[model samples]
Target: MTFTFTVLIYMGEMWKGGPDTVGTLHKLTIKAEPGSVVTCRSAVTIWCEGTMNAEICVLHKEESQKTWGTQTPEMPENKAKFSIPSVTQEHGGQYHCYCYSSAGWSERSDTLEIVVTGIYYKKPHLTALPSPVISPGGNITLKCISWVGYDKLILTKEDQKFLSSMNSQYIHSIRQYQAYFFIASMTQDHIGTFQCYGYYNDTPQLWSVPSDHLKIYISGLSKKPSLLTHQGHILDPGKSLTLQCCSDINYDRFLLYKVGEDNLTEHGNQQTKTGFSLSNFTLDSVSSSTGGQYRCYGAYNLSSEWSASSDPLDILIAGQLPFSPSLSMKPNSTVHSGDNVTLLCQSTNKVDTFILSKEGAAQQPQQLKSKFQVWDFQAEFSMSAVTTALSGTYRCYGSWDSSLYLLTQASDPVELTVSGEVTLHDYKTLHSTAPHLENQDHTLENLIRMGMAVMILIVIGILIFEGWWSQRQDKKSTSHRVPEHGK
Candidate 1:
């Protein structure tokens, strides 16, 4: 007679050959090939490894009631490979495996989640709260928003597992669903590109299309690169702009970051005559959107770490407002030293403020609040005790409170000349005649002083000669008288 033994295990309880051998065996390990996150319609293999003498391996989806059992004879490597020829949303879930051996049934393996992406058509939008350039030990929030009302949103850093998930909150102000993931006490490890997805709770492993990549940068990493432009920061509309990012270090690339922007513009480095590695970022037909605070960073091709940010550069856009202002100077454009001069900026259109800019001046443009005058809105800029240092071509621009960085067309250029105790308007005529007349008068005065000096020296020499002659005659007379007295 042929006798057979059967074992049944359920909920950590096992019945081997008999009730005496009812102990749990070693645990099996389960993993996914390539990655746990797979695209829809792609092939993937789930691997379950167990002891060498394992007889049968069973794979079970935690969310479903069905189970897949395979005999160890099919896979000679003491493992079970379950291949999915064409993956679908149904294949996405958490899975575990168990192996049965001669001793007993093995413990259940750790859960491995399989995520199938591109299952939904709508994609989400990812943005950084406050800014993406964060300092170490600072906190940042990543906001994932979508028009489709997903149950939850998942945030994932590149090459990392799902970092966090949050239930979607409907924002009535924006009419969109969004989830905020807060990361506290940021460090260098948190600096990387990230993406987000939307998913429903019923099928946690199925996800929508990923949002666009957003990069998080850590500030104060290394030496900063320099950001500059050949043209001044103030620009007119429709003008082409090119900003240069340069660094003394041999960086392989450069990134231009605009404040309050979600994305960074990157460019490859090139050799330049300034002996620094540099990159040029160009914007064609610049508009008001191009104006903002900008900075740049240097990075290497092999590393994800970026250098410290460059100094902030503010770009101002002109010719945005409909009307321009008129600039005029009181007491004429030419003024003497210690004279108070007033520059009036007048606009017919209602203006909230006025900005006075001097051509080629290193200081920031001067701003003043506008007041309603008899005929128009105007602002007066007063200069007390003006000097030659203030001499330059000046222009004024009108702006509204709504757009601080945008300005009206520049006013007609006005030239201001501070003569500094001299009348600069007639400077050419005075320069041509005054020097020659002053030289002639100086030569005559010098000649008269030299003649008086010679006359005084001649009088002093005559007085000394007369005293010497008188003394010699007295000595001779005394010698003759002394000889007579002795006789």
Candidate 2:
């Protein structure tokens, strides 16, 4: 005997069951094993999970009408596994699955997109709009561009957790096809390396080669690190420069970022004698392109968050302009303390400003507006009551207002010598005289004593002469009187 089973229709599918309402079956879920993104010729599995009493499952591709079915016991009793031995470009697309049981066919699962990479040879170019360094609650835009005219672009993060796609737009100005992905309110989770891929609309899952990696760094997450350079910020072309990034938080890594630059220079942290963590970045034979505002950040190895940015350091490239300035000190380079001094920086060419820099100074160079003098453009920096602290080797540079970071060649260095205070003793000793007033007083006292001795000797001589004359006269009278008495 032969038995016939009546089939009922629901949601455009034939199933063997009693009369039941459509769209009332339990929903099923579908997911890709490993990941939805697969490399060429790699193995992958599509899982469909539902009720344990499910007898059969059907997997359907959204792009095509192809359907795959799995019987019970071949997979687990509760789920169905549709395995692909070697995935190719044709196997990549949107997919859904349905499971059939006593309750009838389950609702179609949500769509899952399977991407196949490394299908094309040309790769897209990815870049950040302003820079990769971002602060918390900030926004950044990532641009993906290509010449191949792909219709779609996909951006993927390093951890495989973030995936986004956008339709490409033709940019006639740049003659390229591009797409912009804007990330808003950046947080610690947004800090990571990223890459992009390009694909056509017809083959959404088939992608070209991946673009070069672009790293995104989030700042203001921890304490900032200090940036320092032993070499002065103003440097001649072809000079070697080394910048140090230091922090006291024991960070494991350091990142050096130049403003208006897309790439960051990274280095491992080294412990210093003061128990501070630091990293040194060196640039050999630097040219004009090396000059810019720079900042540094510190980060730990295990965490993606970076510390706050260090203070900006502006690097000026010298000898890029046409003319240099001359530096001179008024009233001789050597001056006494408390004397007002003036440093004159003069340039033959018309300059918008003058920069005066002292050697080994940690502060920024002093800038002054240039004034048209009798013969040239000059700026005078007058220092009143100059002290020894102000004495140092100074050089001047000329720069235009438009290009403040680019400067002319350095002028000849002028040395300033500030002598100590000059006392009255010092003035007398310099003229080869007695250093003290007491010696002059002693000489005047000796002259007065000699004059008094001379006066005393003359009075004694006059008295002796008077006494001798008186005695002679008296003896003569006595002699005359005695002779008369005898007659």
Candidate 3:
């Protein structure tokens, strides 16, 4: 590239200002990495001194040893700058500016040490502490990997600020220079490149270009997995409530879904979190139509993929078909006094015990004596003494081999009231209250039946007598006629 060398020049006598302070090298270093930019700077006071044809001067630049890797900035007149492109380790050599004038070249300036300082951290890379690429929804630890022995590390990402880190001295002593950078809860922000750097206290140097980029990633929730109820809750229509989906923070995004026979629909809101409780803060309000098993998920947000699922969680509300266990007596609502009554609690679930309880009774609830009855899918509780005190309210609670469903909250409450027995005076006073049976005309009907039987017997007796008289007359007449014929 053709460029003008613009520099300020002054002669000792001919110009107003004369003597220029000598040039001194301030900061000089040699450094470069594969496919990277290398730069050098210096502090050398230059002045013009030469014959008429061509004025002469010398330029100084930062250097570690005796070599020149980059050229200094353009100067106006006497000062001269020398530069070579793509300077490599082979470019190392002693260098200084020489002026070609009638007086010949000037004395050489002080030598600046030039030595390239790099390649210590061979193939710098990053690694997570736990071997697994994916994370579970809990606590975890991580480490930024580097070539053994490489120190002075700077961890950074494309759009994020750099976060400094250090390798353990113990690790270095054990040849484990790879630094461990801990994050309480692994999150999406941890994804990026981590590099190792070395200072240039001895060479033509600056920070070596960062080592090859290393990528950090967080796995999806499903990568770990969990189990949940298929039909979460049988929520009453229009009841105001919310469902929660949770996981660890290792994934980029999260999802909530309702698994169906044919398809899956979003059950609640989808949110993003950067902290440890990956799923603790994620939840959505419950809707009237929300029903079915739902589970949380950690999204990969990858170019060619889907989110991972977590261990499923099942929620079920009261009144669901496999009902939450409803307790009711044989004759619910109302029953005749002194009737043998049987109470039962039934559910489409497995239960270990069924508790029978009654309110408005003579005794305190828990202290009140109760019974636990068991059956295949239910329990039967019986009480023979039917009293007004016994007539308050009754309910049954079921328990699974494990887990408490807040028996009182999950089960329904039943109301019971008993009536007194009937009596003669009471019945006469409130005859209208009684439903009449067909026994009212029994005696009169019996009398009528007797009279009809007696009359029928008398008529049959008279008919037999008449028939005997007629037969006797006929026999006599026939006998008399036979006797006359014989005479």
- Best of the candidates, TM-score: 1
* Clash pairs detected, candidate 1: none
Full-model lDDT, candidate 1: 0.82
lDDT by residue for model 3 (1-487), tens: 2122322232222123211332232212222232122322222222222212233433333332222322332343333334344345543333344232334323344443332324343544454444323353434344444444444544545443545546434254545455555656655655544444433334323344455544444445346423332222333334544444444445554444444321222222234454432433323454423534455555544521225656444333332224467777776656655555777777656666555556433232221222444644766777564544456766665544343222323457777766776433233323333347234345445766898999999999999999999999999889878867777
Give lDDT tens digits, candidate 2, residues 275-302: 9999999987879888889999999999
RMSD of 2: 13.9
Give all TM-scores, in the order shown. Answer: 0.74, 0.67, 0.26
Question: How many collisions per candidate?
Answer: 0, 0, 37
Ranking by TM-score: 1, 2, 3
After TM-score superposition, the amount by which residue 479's alpha carbon in candidate 3 deviates from its true location, in angstroms, is 40
| Tens-digit lDDT track of model 1 for 209-229 | 899999998765789998988
